[model samples]
Target chain A: MDHGQIEATNLIDRYLTNRATPEECARFEEHFLDCPDCLSRLESTRGLIDGLKQQPPDTFQRRTWVGFMGWIAAAAVTTFAIFRPPPATPPPVTIPGPTLTARAGPVFTLATVRGAQADAPIVTVSGEFTLALDFEPAPGIKGFAVQVTSGTGEQLMSEVEHPLSASGTIGIGLRSQDLKPGLYRAVVVGKSVDGRELQRVIFPFRFQVP
Target chain B: MQSSGTGQSFASPRRSRQDLVSAIVSGDRSAEAELVDWFARGLAIILSRIVKDHQTVEDLRQDSFRIAIERLRSGALRDPDALPGFMAMIARNVAIEHLRQRTPGALSATAPDPTGGPSQYHDLARKQNAAIVRKILNELPQPRDRELLYRFYIADEEKETICERFGLSALHFNRVLHRARERFRELFEKRRSGGGIVPPLDAPDR
Candidate 1:
């Protein structure tokens, strides 16, 4: 076996024997977490503790029952405690009020959009971004949609999923790596599933890639 | 709950609630022992359902007994004859407390993959935290409330047990457990605040 494997085995040995220092045990657990074979062995070894037989309490204890009951009676009789219930507190009142500036429109003006760093680790590895939207949302435009595209016009975005109903939140985002270092155009569409009719607007925007 | 008190040496699935209670109160060591024995099995089953750390559960099983025995010795048991119920209560308090005391985050919670082994040290640490929390829980109310909840949750003991012990139905048991937990939470919060330690809550609720 390789030295690394041997080291792992020794760590496992320490763990099984319960001789491992806490730190060593933590290290061993971390090692086995990524190594499947060792994890299985650890599980099988730990299974033996399950076989313990269940037994009742002792006869000596039971023999103490009459005396025990006597003690309980004695304890209760002398413990003449009077607990008057405390007056209950009233529940808090919640007051809902109206807000002044509810939907004053698109605060996220395109201040500046940047591209990903060339050495960025694992771009496109995780998360969702809006592909296309016709325009910035107005009053109640439900959700906006954009036809995301590569400079080559190849579609690089998934079909627009409802942000509120399906995903619960609406966020505007873009991809950095998949596109060339120039702006490509796409139209945004706004739609809604709330059954309230929404105006759809599509807007074209520049795409940048680093 | 079947009485194990006959020539056949068999536990009856047909035992009445009173039969179980009577057996226990009669100083039948077997009754108390049965309660403890059954408690471990039932708790192991409930715990295994909620948590996958079998090793930790094993250790927890032993700790449950240790706690129950201590309670029994000190007369913390609400109803000594209702040992099974008492055992279950102790077990639940121990389990919940241990679960709470887990050091912050032991699991590497990055979207659990399909073919994965769980974190081992994390489990042990989590169990250790739980044990600590249970110690704190012991400091809250007497073992009876703890046992009542345990009988309700972990042991999944039938309402019949509750009926036999408390002379109340399942619904009353449910409400009682709920209130007991609330009381525990209240005590915990009080301790967290500047509120000084409340004496062991074993202040006996009739």
Candidate 2:
């Protein structure tokens, strides 16, 4: 390996092992971001280290729980095997996965929704109004996903990374005409840079038109 | 500090986990809530170590509980005492699944599928890999070296304690550890590449 590549590899090793100096760490991060070779080495090296560390020590040598762990693993596999349905079949009800509670209290109102539909309570009003959901932007999260779905789970509107207010909330103007009257659900999902869903919260509301 | 639904402390002391599991299994919603309340912070801490983002940690924290609850309700857990470990495994799996989904090619070929079916091949492969790792560790020749590695990485013992056990200065111990880890890495790579065994590189995003 060339001198620079060798040095980068060393830095990466130290970085992973927590032995890198701050200056070396900074340099390593900058170089790896632009260098795929270094990145791959870093990844593989991590894989090697983390892989070894994760194996239970007793399992490495002759130990008793080895069989027990195997049984548990088998049981886990069986559970998923039995519970998971075929790809073609859909579940009857989509239960919302457990999610983090939003940091702030609910702020937006369906006042316009209530006012416009008072005369004809069931029909959605045809107008625009501000819709805001309160939440704190979690650290390291690139963005949040905001989606509006019908009570029966039909997605109506979806947007990603809608900007968060300085006080940590999301505000979007909704046009009532775009929404039909009835119950609708609004969900916000926090996402990481790689687009993993982090925290999800739901707001159930009703829309009416007159 | 994240507060769960319960007005009580997130880390509030709980009844026996066995009892809690039984109650939850028997359809006690309040027991389930109490269990969720008890485990929320612990799960968050465990998840945050691997998953750096607060938002993701919170989400995974909830997922771990949900999955644990589901598994309990479905008779997936045969031993009640294994609940904590089971929950931990589920949380780790949830994080790994997230990583696998985002970058399918990034993971090694042998990585476990989040929703895969039961396979005897996977079991055999894991046992073989574990045996290989054990063989490599056994070849170290020095008991202290082996002990140092075990305490430092696996047991996650404190640095000072590890240093005292080895009669080495902190700086010396780190250097020793660096070399030890490098040796382990070399042996691991040799085995993995030669045997076509894939190493797991999946770390929850920080």
Candidate 3:
């Protein structure tokens, strides 16, 4: 399968919306696996579908009013609202905040700090947060084993063999409350399927709780 | 390795389908990993469309890969070039069997849970992408077009029904979809380049 065939059949859209037959689905998948362009398109289209589903019913609704009658109606409503007495204040309601999951935190990309400490990327994090380590994986490297440590060489977190995204990034969520404000380094080692290390990259950053 | 018009090179090296199959069959670990890496994302996307739960989708993906490897090793696949199609078929069948097992009045066995739930990375990516898409949808100028997208993609309504409801020709319907996808790609590229949360490594920081 090629881009021509993909466009001719509208395979990306159909496959995303579940409108494609099994045969079409198989063919498209096969094509995209080796085709980055198709893979990127598939991701964006899927994003569009997911975004549309998240929208409320009234998202696309439009409201229109007629001519002079519309102006008069609007004025009347405004006048009534201005003249009407405010309703009695309701009792204060205390609603509990929604519990925060690991995903509820803000994500920040951690990059290698090449020069002085003052030039290192500093992130102000409160509560839970995620640190995204982005790197280009060597050919045939599919995953990474990530280990994070403080400036003092104290190990903070370690994750074994996390899969790399198609866009070549891995994210690790952490809590600010767990560590003191200081510099940290993420030791990311690319790994093959058999847990063999291919390459190692270090990202240094500092976090201050505010 | 095929390069796109944009000059982006694919990571997978160019190898004949037969060579890859033969390599895997000869107990080449690199070949196995290469095969998995090539098809993992596509398989995940395909299975995720059919299965709702992230954990279940991941499980099905693994099952598909294992089954495909076993079949290839046994010389069950006649056409080496049909490997992709065969992988897709295996993934779909795995997903279907999983769904069938979960259905009521079917043979009752404890369903397997793989990896417990979706990884944090998957969840984060989904949330980030959805936010970008929502922004694009809101900025869409045409209410009709927005409604058409919602009805077609989200509602899963038939194309003919959508066209009739919107009083559009078949050609127009296709145009709307094409334009929407193009618009999305434009914004997605912008986000990637403009220092968004998940910017590429070389992207300049704000």
Candidate 4:
């Protein structure tokens, strides 16, 4: 807090900017050791630098601070739950959770997206989505299929085969070019080799694309 | 740009995966190069865990990526979101098969028994060091550079923010971000090696 400390505090900015010369760095270091004030200043500046570096450059907050985001999400959810309401008399909306088989998991599904425009290109849409699936790998059998539905509520595609070796995104390309864009949904039904619906897991996900 | 409907966090992985797919499908050579550049280290890590020979692992790492690219081109890899993971699995299985074929009786032929032969600690340590290096980049002098590095590369920010701030199209932003990441990687590598912070990774150099 004296003149030297005051000067040292300012010198940090200079050193960081690389404007400080070797002599200045040496001078700063010598004073830094003797004066606790400069030492604290130096550490604080380094801390600031480290803080700045680790931050997600797009935002002032760093990723290490990402833990706080959980709280934010919680707050949003809480607010939505409190303030958001159902559409006026929108007859008791029903979410149909898919019927689970006797298997341990949900069934695998293959699907595609379309646009409202007749010429709406499939290129505008994406195929990545999560599947609630019942995995019943029959030893050496490589592929399995459930069913597929088009955006128009029609069974435009079905019996799509997914291999066991493929765990991530299995590619079901737009096999048919004559697809119109609209709301599409699929019901993935499955059973084990014994033809009994398994029941261990029934994970389900819903999403949309343009 | 995506709608505020989905929010930012959810937008990134989906959007970028889409960008990569679009670029590859649209026949952008630079996108292919960028994908290779970003994934080289990840591929190397997968290769190391599988292949025993150091030289062979590096070669196989490159080979698997080439295979991945071929798959992308041929539409074998239909979904872009799982591209990297799929490629790694292919590399992993290939190495396993090669080891089994080479020496069925040799205990060392397959990947090291995950239990103890190799130091899993070293693997963890390397990951920590990389994280620390990422931490250091934010400490650099330039604010814009920090912003670019964090959002574009580390946090894996989507194309939207770049579009907002820079007003660049997807292709333009992709080009810029790709170069920015390269510069940042170079800086990170320099600091990492010079800091002499972590000793040469002790994972048997495999």
In TM-score terms, which candidate is top?
3
**What's the lDDT for residue B17 in model 3?**
72
DockQ of each: 0.01, 0.03, 0.14, 0.02
Give the candidates in order of TM-score, highest first: 3, 2, 4, 1
CA lDDT, candidate 4, residue A109: 29
Q: Candidate 1: where is the Cα deviation over 4 Å?
A: A1-210, B1-32, B80-84, B106-206
Q: Report the C-alpha lDDT of model 2 over B1-206, residue by residue, as the tens digit.
A: 12122223223535666677788889888888986865554454345434434456667778888888888888787876555556666765786666545443221212233333323544444445455545656665544555555444433334576687447787766665556556545665776778765433323211
> What's the true lDDT of residue B112 in model 2?
31
lDDT of 4 at B132: 53
Instruction: Give the per-residue lDDT of model 3 (tens digit) for B1-206.
Output: 33331212346645567778888888887887878877787787777765655666667889999998888888898888777678878887887777655643111112233234445755565566666666776676665677577556643446787698557998988888887777777877887788664411111111
Give interface RMSD, per candidate: 24.8, 22.0, 16.2, 23.0
Off by over 4 Å in 3: A63-210, B1-11, B105-123, B190-206
Look at candidate 1 and tell me the lDDT of residue A37: 43
> By summed lDDT, which 10 consecutive residues of candidate 3 chain A come out lowest?
A95-104
Question: How many backbone clashes does every candidate have?
Answer: 23, 4, 0, 22
lDDT of 3 by residue, A57-110 (tens): 335333111112233445567587445443333111121112111111133444
Using lDDT as the yardstick, the better of models 3 and 4 is 3
Chain B, TM-score, each prediction?
Answer: 0.38, 0.47, 0.76, 0.47
Which digits, one per residue and each the tens of the lDDT, describe model 2 over residues A1-210?
Answer: 233555534555455543454455444443333233454556445543444443552322321122223334455665874454333321111111122111111113221211112221223322333345433334445466788888788878876455322223355446656777788766777677678876666656666543
Stretches > 4 Å off in candidate 2:
A1-14, A17-27, A33-48, A57-210, B1-129, B155-161, B170-175, B191-195, B203-206
Runs in model 4 lying further than 4 Å from the true structure: A1-210, B1-15, B108-206
Evaluate residue A7 in candidate 4 and report its C-alpha lDDT on the 0 to 100 scale: 50
Error of 1 at B33 (Å): 3.9
